[model samples]
Target: MEENKREVQVTLVESILIMIGMFAILGALIIGAEMPPQIPILLVFTLLMFYGRLRHVTWDQIFAGIIEGIKPGIIPIMIFLMIGLLVSSWLRSGTIATIMVIGFKILSAQFFLLTVFLICCLIGITVGSSFTTISTMGIAFMGIGHILGFSAAITAGAIVSGAFFGNNMSPLSDTSNLTTGLTKVNLYDHLKNMAITAIPSALITLGLFFILGRTSSTADLTQTQQISQQLQRSFNVSIWALLPILVLLLLAWRQVPAIPTLLVGSLTALVVILVSSPGYSVSQIGTLLMNGNAAKTGSHTVDRLMSGGGINNMLGSVSLIIVALALGGLLIQYGVVHTLITSIKQYVNTPGKLILLNMLSGIGVNFLVGEQYLSIILPGTTFMSSYDRLGLPRKYLTRTLASGGADVNALVPWGVSGVFIAGTLGVNPLAYVPLAFYAYIDPIITILFGFTLVTWRYRRSGKRPATSTATTSVGLKDRDQPVN
Candidate 1:
């Protein structure tokens, strides 16, 4: 007869072993072999499953754990897919093209780096996507910088800095939403809390870019004009294109749910597309929604910028989230997370220490795993109890996750964001690290605030209990005893 076994609490040693194995496998494959994160993450998942099986965990129980882990991510996955649709629809309706045209018209060579930074920031915020901004406006800015005799490294740095800055703050940002969702913090509240550090970092970045961008050469605007002309030729570059974005902003301002807000925005864009381009068939519109925009503007740069989005594009992120969450769930189910947290609980005595630890863990995960999502997921899940036990709100955790995880990814040489930026901008990833000022600066400011207790919000009682017990599906049962 087969034997039935109850779930076992993973010991501290076992937890450490699991972590070490995870780090080794992820680092070896993702960094050493330079494979995409999905494969490495899958390997880690398999490793955890083997460990679980040795501990007598049943396949049924394992499946349950996976489901539990994925539950928290379902909403985020939906939002990611919606964002894809929104991007594709907006592109088809000329919304993105119009914005790009406006951004190009305002460019001046005198404040080239500053203008590049500001334009990227604008586009990033408007689109609420760093990669999109980087691939499009960032590519154009790099071409302009090369012609104007600016160092490619400094220009790439400016692009990354501005793009991530807008990404960190924009309500429509997937990372921003993912942070808030995982931490259960209100989206607007999270954005507001982040501004405490984001604004200052942006200002410092602006000043640095301005100082570095001082160039005496009067460069021709031929490249810029060509790209702008191509965009204008391909799409309707007019004020009407702004309507969908305005509607999205209005819905977000009213605090509507992210999924619906994105859907409404996409639908609005579709309406605009149908009205303006009556020649578009229903099947063509469907293709755009499913496969993204395919029309070429005859300019390679313009074509690159215009071609992206669609539900299919988000499947990779969706799959990663599912697998990563399943890993997290198994870790929690087997008590690896609890054991590790308990071991570290004594050292994270204060909010400052907790914040610092979370930041460090995030950066470490980014370096080790080379994936931004895992960096946010692992640290955010690990430190959640620490945040609650100290009477601190979870928004602080959300902000720090953004500071240490999402923003920092673009600086890691092997990181997904870093690799993409390097390839798109034609500069070595490491070369631009020094100039990607906002990425590191935000984390520094967040850590400083933690130590100084600046802008820190506490519970209404302003006093936390010595210990609190909580139990959930992921099994955070161990009570945290904060050090006095």
Candidate 2:
């Protein structure tokens, strides 16, 4: 069976056809028909299964591939559930309300978007998780944006751009650490190299957002004051409400795993609700956790802002992730992705071509697989030897991975990050793509660097680039296996 499997290689034509078919089906169903992404993804998965059968792959092989694909998303799925709980807990504990109230008092309409971008950047860097930032700070900003009369699409765009920028740069981010670990580059060196592109992209993004803020509709001070007063009355808005956010950030800084950090944050929120409010019983808290905050704060704006969160709200995202990952698994199991990568490798003779191809491959994987980790892992692994052969330092490859793989995932409509963000922010996933300047800008800058050799570093003649010993500190056991 192993020998037979080795002999079964998907041709370039077959791979290309499958990819085109996938895009067509997804486009027709998602864009043309305006159906939800899960249905289209499931249809694509079924078609791929049939295609796999035609390629002589066994049913067992296909099922195994799906299971393998889902393995990568298990932690993310767990995080999703915990995030649902955390959001609701924070809502009940007045954390989000306090942030919104405080934001209205200090944040101006002129720099609202700019301030939102910077604040989210700080929170994202501190937490090292885009999802967490999006759920907590992102939610608060959305409420403020609504109260301030900004469009949700534009607000979500700025939030996503800043959150992902920090995610790419944070030392504790899984994708950043994964990119450096897989490519055998020093973490800090990769970060510094990433700045070559990241800085320009971020500055450009900030400028664009500043202009948007300037042109935004004037803030309604009366409405803002009314909402602030209502929020204070409905929830116990105090400094004590911020303990949950502080706890989450401190755990992230300490390098604790994401799951435990979220769990602890949720637990802390429950404690805050009990000690600070003292009106709700333990049973009521459990009910709130399961069914979300049911408090009718009397103000329509406050009610709209605080009504969501709970495991029920997250089930849609979780379902979408499962189907998408299963589809990605079949793509990998059927050799479509491998064929595409191998066919593209022949033309990567120069450093410029290699960098461009690497970036494109990472973006392509995000579109095809809808999983971010594979976007980094596949291209980084495929081109690792090529970079070494070209005498280019591994930092270039890792930086490119962050630019193309990690950052771009949020723009992919069916991607895990995209789905989660859309569900959390209550915006269409595609609506914010055009405004996510940093996500797309970094790749363009990195590609330009590749062609210009502006920031490229070369290994000494007759010597290969040395692997960084610092990789062990990131807890990477071996190059073959990245930490989850």
Number of the top lDDT candidate:
2
Candidate 1 worst ten-residue window by lDDT: 475-484
> Per-residue lDDT for 1-484 in model 2, tens only?
4444455467889899989999999999998999999999999999888878887888778887898788899999999999989999999899999999999999999899999999888888888889989999999999999999998999999999899989987898899889977876778877787877888888999999999999975678899999999999889799999999899989999999989998899999999988987777878877787777776977777899987888888999999999999999888877788889868887976668889999999999999999999999999889887665555667778988888888889999899999999999999987889988888988999999888753233311233322444332323223322111
Considering every candidate listed, which one attains the maximal TM-score? 2
TM-score of each: 0.72, 0.93
Mind giving the per-residue lDDT tens digits that candidate 1 earns over 171-227?
888899889888777888888889989999999999988877765334667876887
lDDT agreement of model 2 with the native: 0.86
Cα lDDT for residue 452, candidate 1: 72
- Residue-pair clashes, model 1: 0
> Candidate 1's C-alpha lDDT?
0.76
Q: Which stretches of candidate 1 lie over 4 Å from their true place?
A: 1-6, 109-196, 211-220, 349-351, 361-436, 452-484
Prediction 1 TM-score vs. true: 0.72
